[model samples]
Target chain A: DVKVTQSSRYLVKRTGEKVFLECVQDMDHENMFWYRQDPGLGLRLIYFSYDVKMKEKGDIPEGYSVSREKKERFSLILESASTNQTSMYLCASSSVPSYNSPLHFGNGTRLTVT
Target chain B: QKEVEQDPGPLSVPEGAIVSLNCTYSNSAFQYFMWYRQYSRKGPELLMYTYSSGNKEDGRFTAQVDKSSKYISLFIRDSQPSDSATYLCASFTSGTYKYIFGTGTRLKVLA
Candidate 1:
């Protein structure tokens, strides 16, 4: 089974603190994505990486950035945590050979900002 | 206008009931349609994907897409409590890595 792993399943951070969410996929997928899911808003893409050292801003990329240093790992960075940023963060990965390839997602990390 | 729209229904039904979930899209170029189910506190899991503008069935689930109407539907037969979750509909176009997702409809299959 393809596995996508996030560093933390749950996280709590103080306002103004920097946060890092890590995602690693074992399927050797070329595409990785970060999304924040909010109640009634669905899944909003934050950022995505199609290859190492390449990143693209999604619909809601403000206050967030991404790093893809290796083929199997992608990281989402929050410059400064705020109460409004508390939400469920999801990581997903898919191969490039198929544009409609199914995404394998991590369990997700629910962050609470205080 | 939003590219994709779905009713976020907290639809309730008894076990064995047939459930239908639907989503409409404004993007006519979306050639790929997909359905995902997400349990509480868990990530969304891919359930069905269809590229053709017709119907595809797997097990007790059926995914139907009508490109002319720009609408998609998911049908669940003999629904069970285990099938209760938030169902999300997504659409994708060629050459784009992004898939637009709907707000998701929540279903409760009471046992």
Candidate 2:
């Protein structure tokens, strides 16, 4: 069984404050993804990293950034958090054989920006 | 129209009843189908996956995909309260990182 650990379960931040959400996967998967799950919008991708020091923007990438200094760890950064940025963030990882493999996801980090 | 569509159902059913959840996709390029279960305040956990138009069963859950109709389904047998959660379906084409996910359907198995 693969374990994906998130740094926080609940986060509260003030508007204009910088915030960071961290995630780590035990399995040596090559691909890591960050997504925000909203009420009606469903799960929208934020950023993804395919390799160390590499990153790509997803559908909703505004007001967000990512860092993947290591293969096992992926971090999402908010330069200036806003109330609208408050949502549940999810991290997932998959290996190169993504065809048959499903993305193993972490529990999640729920953020509340005021 | 959305690429993938799922009913935002708060389907309520009694325990030990069979539960059916489904989704439909508009893109014919989608070749892989996946089902995920998400509890409140949690990330989605993959429940099942199918390569194409076929039925795959695992324990109490079965996933079916019909490429001709662009439809996918997940059936849960003898539902338990533990099965109460949101079910989401996803589809993606081969050799691509882009995956389209349905809006998700919420289910409650009453005791």
Top DockQ prediction, candidate number: 2
Please write out the lDDT profile of model 1 over residues A1-114, one tens digit for every residue: 779999999999999999999999998899999999999788999999999999999999999989999999999999999899999999999888365576778999999999
lDDT of each: 0.93, 0.93
Candidate 2 has which clashing residue pairs, if any?
none
The local lDDT score (0 to 100) that residue B43 gets in candidate 2 is 82
Which regions of candidate 2 deviate over 4 angstroms?
none
Docking category of candidate 2 = medium
Q: What's the true lDDT of residue A34 in model 2?
A: 96
Instruction: List TM-score per model, in order.
Output: 0.97, 0.97
Please state the error at residue B47 of candidate 1 in Å.
Answer: 0.1
List candidate 1 segments past 4 Å from native: A97-100
Question: Model 1 chain A: which ten-residue window has the lowest total lDDT?
Answer: A95-104
Model 2: per-residue Cα lDDT over B2-90, one tens digit each: 99999999999999999999999999988889999999988889999899899999999999999999889999999999999999999
Separately for all candidates shown, the number of backbone clashes (residues 3 or more apart, or on different chains) is 0, 0
Q: How does model 2 fare in lDDT?
A: 0.93
